[model samples]
Target: MQPTHRSRRILRPVRIWFVYLSLCVALLLSYVPTGQVPGVPDWVALLLAFWCVRERQHVGMGAGFIFGVLVDIGYGAAMGQHALAYVLLAYAANAVSRRVLWFTPLQQSIQILPLLLGAQLVMVVVRMLAGAEFPGWGYFLSSVTGTLLWLPLHFVLLLPQYQPEERDNNRPI
Candidate 1:
């Protein structure tokens, strides 16, 4: 049976702040570095990647540049450091978003790992160009950590918008 207009609208839960809140959480986490590695997982990059994969139209390279600038300022790193990296990351995520979104979050985690690594790689390359000392292989660990965190982050961010399971009244005998 087709859902009524009201039910249809109800089923399509869309909260604008859900995206902003996720960004805010990532922004805050960026300031709170954690991990046994030399670099912290790029929280904002991961967040941006998830949104790009989940909802491309709503988030894109522009969003990445904006947040990337914020991170650059917050960390007092080189200007456009994260900006360039994030733009590339979002662009990459958006590139394969179609195929990636079709998979489960766990699968997405695996697929997006390299993109996450690429973002970190971009950042490292930028820092290196700016004459910053190499942080060693430990720096790359953030990608793995970020990839592992993707499933949890995806579920938690989507939790608020999740609809209750519909009754299977149309089940066949």
Candidate 2:
């Protein structure tokens, strides 16, 4: 029993690492070209928001900053642009984490839309500041799509983690 318990404890960190691995996969998918496809949802943002609402303690501003920097470096954007945006998004999500977690997926999506939009707004502002031309209203489409994706992503990603506990009806009083 002691050996089994010790091994279980060792696996806990590996499980936590799997979460980060999934996030990295989402980040990679964000950059996948879709042959002129429009409104490609920001997988990183969606994942971060979901993790924030689902496991707030695990998805903090630090995670946001790290992932944001990874995104900036991977996507060839200005340094600290995505970093700042993601950190702000994480902070906003964390602020309302307690409240948001109680809401259904649809409600959660509605509540989180602002934060997702805010992240995009940050990107736009940064680009504009750098003398880049506007990318048009189409740029906002990702937020909408990302919001729509929340329901399925939330349910699906959390499905494996949901474990129903059994009640002991035969216990002696």
Please list the C-alpha lDDT of all candidates, in the order they appear: 0.85, 0.80
- Model 1: per-residue Cα lDDT over 75-153, one tens digit each: 8999999999999999999999999976777888999999998998899999999999887898898899888898788
Best by TM-score: 1
- Whole-model lDDT, candidate 2? 0.80
Report the C-alpha displacement of residue 109, candidate 2, in angstroms. 0.8
Q: Which candidate tops lDDT? A: 1
**Candidate 2's residue-wise lDDT over 1-173, tens digit each?**
34332212111112456578778989899778664465888898888877876677777889999999999988888888888889999899999989997666788899989999999999889978988888889888889999999888876776555432444578421
Query: After TM-score superposition, what is the CA distance of residue 8 in candidate 1 from its true location, in Å?
Result: 16
Decoy 2 TM-score against native: 0.83
Candidate 1 lDDT score relative to the true structure: 0.85
Cα RMSD of predicted structure 2: 8.4
- Model 2 misses residue 61 by how many Å? 0.8
